[model samples]
Target: MVATAETGVRRAAGTVPRPLRGTGIGWLFVTPFVVVFAVFWAGPLLVGLGMSFTDMRSTDVRNPLGVELVGLRNYLRLFDDELMRRAAVNTLVFVVTTLPLTIGLGLAAAVALNSGIARLPAAFFRLGYYLPYVTSIIGIAVAWRFLLDPEAGPVNQLLAAVGVDGPSWLADETLALPVIIVMTAWRSFGFDMIILLAALQGIPKELYEAAEVDGAGRWARFRWVTVPMLRPALLFCTVYSSIGFTQFMEEPLVMTRGGPAGATTSASLAIYNQFGSGNFGYAGAAATVLFTVIAALAFLQFRLGRSR
Candidate 1:
């Protein structure tokens, strides 16, 4: 009976499956990424955090072991720093103005292109809009500087043709920041437009047809159907543009250098100026504060997105 049972079991188990491999192999594949992240990203972050609590300066490079911990002194100084205050206000203004404009223009462009009004290939229009985003920032800044030149720029020249004198865009403190905001918005809207376009494409045509059959007009359908469907994309673009605007540096640095009485200075530019002046501790403190603000904003955006 035992022998018969054993033979029956062998017959039932014909072509036995191999045992599944363990997760050890998967860990091995991910080990390199983990190692690199720890060494580069995690390590630097920890060091920077430590540096923020101390009076670490560029001169300390000669005596790396002799740094003194001042315990919040750097952070306290930030409150009294007039330049930092100006930078913070400038950054806030940039965020308030640029975020809406970027998202609005992007959505408008996406809608127009998706509507097929240009009578050109969609790819051509898409590429044309996206070109500035891919181009180098320095190159764009240089071109814009020329275009915004009060005396020789084509923009001012065009204004002259119409007998409207263009302001000294980069020279006047009052207009400089606004000009930078506009330039930044133009360069950034392309990315948001592309993302929104993809989201728009993913929406089913039946939804629009259903709305039309239900007596929904163009604006009504857009408000009821389109906006709701595009909420996730819009949320992403808003949060992304918000963060970028808050941390604005390169444009102001290259274009204005925080000039015209530092009207265009941003938090990043302030940090850069501090770092350049060998006030490493102060810079790190400012950086940590900026990081906190960005993190808080991101958290709020996430909560809002989830709530909606």
Candidate 2:
């Protein structure tokens, strides 16, 4: 009788019985991550926002209860501060100069490696390019600092051997920021290359064959097929590189100390300087500004990518 009823029900429904819905037991595995994120990431972000509005000095570390709210005065003071202005400009310069170079070089390298013309194993080439990224940033900075040293560095020595005098890279105000930009591009392009290479590989070979059948030249094929297909990956690399360049601090700190008349002081380094000078509230305000800028840029990039 039970079989008969089940058959009748299925006949009436015109389909077999559906399985029971999941009870969401799978979420139990993700609970630990949620808890950790709330405690660490979300918790400190809220605390930092609160600190940005108060007169919090480094000495008040022992007594967080003593901080007095100063409203937006710390933020307002940013406009009148010359050093802050310079830092912001320097940061903008770094982003403007580094973003295109990094993306362009990365794309070029990815294309070259993908073409299989190098006669080396592709993984070997990828690992060689990505090695600097996994290496310590401090170590890279220190090594580059010595390599760019005016008197004894190999880079300048090579230039001298060619009968051309190289400028004091980190010591010259005019050249300090550019030197950092080059070093940063060299160390960071590998990640972009890997991402772009993946995007390139995912493009269907059939499209290229069709383009060829239509009598398109190599550049024409790449322009019509490769670029459009790789749009998402390119956008990701651009936005990621922008955020990294905006937050640049370590290289300048280690290599130039933001020196040569403060030519290389980035916004992040400015915040670090404020905190080092015991002005916690001021540092927090700078951080808040940086956060706003990054958020806005990311939103803009997302909109652009979606629209495209």
Output the number of the TM-score-best candidate.
Answer: 1
Question: Which tens-of-lDDT digit does each residue in 1-308 have in candidate 1?
Answer: 22335689898679656438876876889999999999998887787788899999999978968899999999999999999999999999999999999899899999988885655677888888888989888999899999999998999999999999899989899998999999888998999999999999899999999999999999999999999999888988987789888999999999989988999999999999999999888899999999999989987887777776
Give one digit per residue, the lDDT tens place, for model 2 in 54-110.
999999999999999999999999999999999999999999999999998899989
Error of 2 at 95 (Å): 1.0
Point to the candidate with the largest lDDT.
1
lDDT of 2: 0.89
TM-score to true structure, per model? 0.90, 0.88
Task: Look at candidate 1 and tell me the lDDT of residue 20.
Answer: 83
lDDT of model number 1: 0.90
Scored against the true structure, residue 235 in model 1 reaches a CA lDDT of: 85
Candidate 2 regions with alpha-carbon error over 4 angstroms: 1-27, 118-121
Q: What's the lDDT for all of these models?
A: 0.90, 0.89
Number of clashing residue pairs, candidate 1: 0
